[model samples]
Target chain A: AQRVTQVQPTGSSQWGEEVTLDCSYETSEYFYRIFWYRQLFSGEMVFLIYQPSFDTQNQRSGRYSVVFQKSFKSISLVISASQPEDSGTYFCALSELGTNTGKLTFGDGTVLTVKP
Target chain B: NAGVIQTPRHKVTGKGQEATLWCEPISGHSAVFWYRQTIVQGLEFLTYFRNQAPIDDSGMPKERFSAQMPNQSHSTLKIQSTQPQDSAVYLCASSLDITGSQNTLYFGAGTRLSVL
Candidate 1:
């Protein structure tokens, strides 16, 4: 079974500080896809980023960026200049390509609290 | 243009009751995914559809959970004999493209299920 494990359950950081959320996965497939999502109290889940293993390119959109490392079987999301609005539950998900299943295995989320 | 739309943002049902969750994918999207999220289990893939056909449902519970996508624009997930344990947030996501590395899933606000 493929599983994405995000060890940190909760973390707090001050505004304008850098915060990192770690994710690691174990799967038999040689390649995998990773995704980051933020879920708020309103029951809305927002897509933050998506990364495929073949392309090591770090996806950056404004203050949010994700780094995918194949060798370490890990992925990390870095928030630069974090703000209060960034506080939410962050999740990591993965799926192996070619399966058409479109089923994504997600990790237990990390709740981030950005303080003012 | 509405990304993914899920109906009945919240539902309350009794054990053994039946509940159905609906999802309308983006206008031109061909892939739709359903996931269940809870505090204990986090996010789990329930099933997926590609090109209006059932692709994979390996993550679904066999007895009470079933999903269908009769057309490209909409999909439905039905749960029979709903139990308190089945209560969770059901999320739907859609992507314009189903293949390759660029497929990004845009999600809905999710439907929260409450069972008594």
Candidate 2:
């Protein structure tokens, strides 16, 4: 079975500080993908970034990036120059490669508070 | 694009009542997914559909939960005999077809179900 784990249940960061939210996953499939999503206070789930297991180079999108440690089955989302608007509950999810269902097994999320 | 749309932003139901959550996927998207978010369980994969067909629902409770995608534009999650434990924010998301390898999901502002 594939599972994702977010050890920190809550985290806080001052505005302009770089914040790193950690996540680890267990998957039998050597080829898989990890995704980050932020659920805003208004209850919308927003896709952030994703990392495929095959890619050794981490992926980045604007101010959001990922530190993927494939060997440890761990990945962390790094948000640079954090802002209060970023406060939300962030989720890490895992999707196995080749599963036509496209099902994502999610981790217990980390609630983040970005204070300005 | 309007993004995915879920109706009834909030729902209140007593025990043993039935709750049906509706989702309208983004236009032209071929994959729709359902997830449940609670403080404890976090984000749980409830089910998914591909090409408007039921794909996988392994995470769904076999007893009171059922999901259907009758057409390309919409899907529904029905829960019978909702209990307090069933209370959660139900999220609906849709993505481009898996064949396209663009499985990133765009989500709706979920339906918050309060089971009393």
Candidate 3:
């Protein structure tokens, strides 16, 4: 069974400050992927970033990047220059590779509040 | 591309009533997924379909929950004898294909089901 965990239920950040949200996962599969998504207030989920377990180098997309600790089975999302508009519940999801199920296991999410 | 579209932004049903949620995936996408989100459970995978075929439904409650993708244009999730415990936001996502490990899923706004 694959599972994702986000220890922090809530987090806060000031405008223009950097924010980091942590996540961990348990998976028996050798190949897997960790995904991050932001749920907007309108109830839409926006894909943020993803990291593959086989890649030693972390993945980065614009201001959003991930610190992937593959050895520890953990990953952290770093958002630079956070703005109030970034406030929402962030979800970390896991998908086992080589499995055609295409199922995603998600974390409890962290409600982030970016104060302006 | 208009992305994925879901109907009935909100739904309310009393105990024992039936509810149906709709989802229209993006054109050309080959994989569709159903997920349930609640304050307590976060996001849980319900079912998935690929190439218009039922792929996996291990997470669906066998008794009252069922999903179907009759055509490529849309899908439906039906809940019979809806209970208060079934209240949640139903999310639908679509991926271009499921064969790749980095397939990113585009999500819809979701249907908020409130069971009273």
Instruction: Summing lDDT over every window of 10 consecutive residues in candidate 3 chain A, give the lowest-scoring window.
Output: A95-104
Q: What TM-score does the A-chain of candidate 2 achieve?
A: 0.97
Error of 3 at A42 (Å): 1.6
Which residue pairs come into collision in candidate 3?
Answer: none
TM-score rank, highest first?
3, 2, 1
lDDT string for model 1 (A9-94, tens) is: 99999999999999999887766688898888787888888778888688888888988788899999999999999999998988
lDDT of each: 0.87, 0.91, 0.92
> Cα RMSD (Å) between model 3 and the true structure?
1.1
Candidate 1: TM-score? 0.94
lDDT of 3 by residue, A1-116 (tens): 77899999999999999999999999999988889999999999999999988899999999899999988999999999999999999999988876856577899999999998
Worst ten in a row by lDDT for model 1 chain A: A95-104
Ordered by DockQ, highest first, the candidates read 3, 2, 1
Clashing pairs in 1: none
For model 1, residues B18-61, the per-residue Cα lDDT tens digits are 99999999899888989898888788888888888887887799
Q: Please give the lDDT score for candidate 1.
A: 0.87
- lDDT (10s digit) by residue, model 2, range A17-110: 9999999999888778899999899999899999988999999999999999998999999999999999999999988876656678888888
Q: For candidate 1, give the docking quality class from DockQ.
A: medium
